[model samples]
Target: MPRAKRFYIPGCVWHITHRCHKKEFLLKFARDRNRWLDLLFRAKQKYGLEVLNYIVTSNHIHLLVSDNGNRDTIPKSMQLIAGQTAQEYNIRKKRRGAYWEDRYHATAIQVDTHLASCLIYIDMNMVRTGVVSHPSEWRWSGYNEIQNPKKRYAILNYRRLMELLGCESLDALKEVHGQWIEDSLKKGKPAREKKWSRGIAVGSREYIENIQTKLGVKAIHRKIHESKDSSELREDQSPYTAIFGTENERLRQENTYRWGLF
Candidate 1:
């Protein structure tokens, strides 16, 4: 099947994840994690994106970011970043072939609630996975930036989240952050499914409806009737390969005589 186009628009936040092929342990050491972080920083600087939260697990990575680039450009930027990281990793480890799956998966966070949920989801990923007891214990994320005043990572902007939460003081922001963590502990139960545990935004109906409206479409469900002779419905050839070939051939014929008319 042809890959679907990635959706990336300005002012949009995405919960993005990419796993190693076959879920292998790609990031087995500190150097591996550091390389991933370096790639993320370079990507942010080059693409003019804000990395809200991120976690580099042993096999996969999660990113919550906002891009200032034009909507269509974000996917290209992400592809470039992922490709760069995968190339470096493969080369350094003396590996071959593709490092990641076909593409990174992204889910649009539509509302503030969804964003909040996604943020909590990302921060608590390590906690839910038994990698750490608390989010602050996870060394790969911005939790250190949140809890430590002197510590700083250029990609993390705690003030931005404070502003988003409408908190005027850092103290207030810290309090809010604490409360959020507490509430999340109560509400954000351990995710049984791996995908959801890896920062997938479980959105509400309203959020989904908004997505449909933004995409300019309505999703309809259809029931598949069972048939014994399923082979009859199968296509021997893909039509996508020839969708524009006829027009291209006509244009080629039209141009051939012009070049040879002399």
Candidate 2:
């Protein structure tokens, strides 16, 4: 298959996914996962990457970030993290070949309910796979970091997060976030959503169309898909964009910044 082309758009949030080479479970161990997170922290320090949410799983990684309108931030940070990770792991194991499946897949996300939904979806990943019953059970995730914030080396932009969620305080955000999780769990086993991993952009009609316009040639052939709740722009033949919904209380938060996405 041809390498997936990256579409760059400034001032947006992005959901990034990268998998281990041939799904070998390279990060199946805690130490490797921790190393990836450590490199992620350093990438934050070195590049000012505004990480919103993340999860380092056995064979893949999910990162939710608010681009700072600096085009190089995302790619550069990825290079540092992925490159160093692969190099270190290979040297440690005395192995060779690719550590990553390819490069990665990035989906632009609309802020507000869509963004919030994406956050919960990411945290629920392990739960969906039955690795754990709840997101808190998994240590390598932003959800854990948020509920139990670290005094040092913390990730996630709390203030910006609050602004995005239309909340006034961390306590409120936490309460609302937990409620969202609880509400989600009550819905039973969550199935994987393709929009986050496959779509070029996910949001409302206007938002996706706007992204498509901005993407110009790259998105020329892609099409927008509309369902009852939301709209998405996706390729002709694959998992594409999506629409979403949350009942009453979950629909409260209605909204990121000059975030560049890759």
lDDT per residue (tens digit) for residues 1-262 in model 2: 2343464677889999999999989999899999999999999999999999999999999999997867789988999999999999999999999999877788989997899999999999999999999999999999987787677889777877788788898888889999999999999999998888888889999998788667554454588988777798876653222222123213312221213333
Separate clash counts for every candidate: 0, 5
Q: C-alpha displacement of 191 in model 2, angstroms? A: 0.5
Best by TM-score: 2
Q: Would you estimate the TM-scores of all the predictions?
A: 0.73, 0.88
For candidate 1, what is the lDDT? 0.60
lDDT for each candidate structure = 0.60, 0.83
Off by over 4 Å in 2: 236-262
Candidate 1 TM-score, true structure as reference: 0.73
Off by over 4 Å in 1: 149-153, 186-189, 192-202, 217-262
Instruction: Give the alpha carbon lDDT tens digit for every residue of 1-262 in model 1.
Output: 5533332333556678888888888777888788788777776677666676788888888887764444544465567667887888888879898788667776556446556666777888888888777788878775655655434447655556665656787778677767788877776556743333322233554544444343321111211122231110111123334333444334423211111000
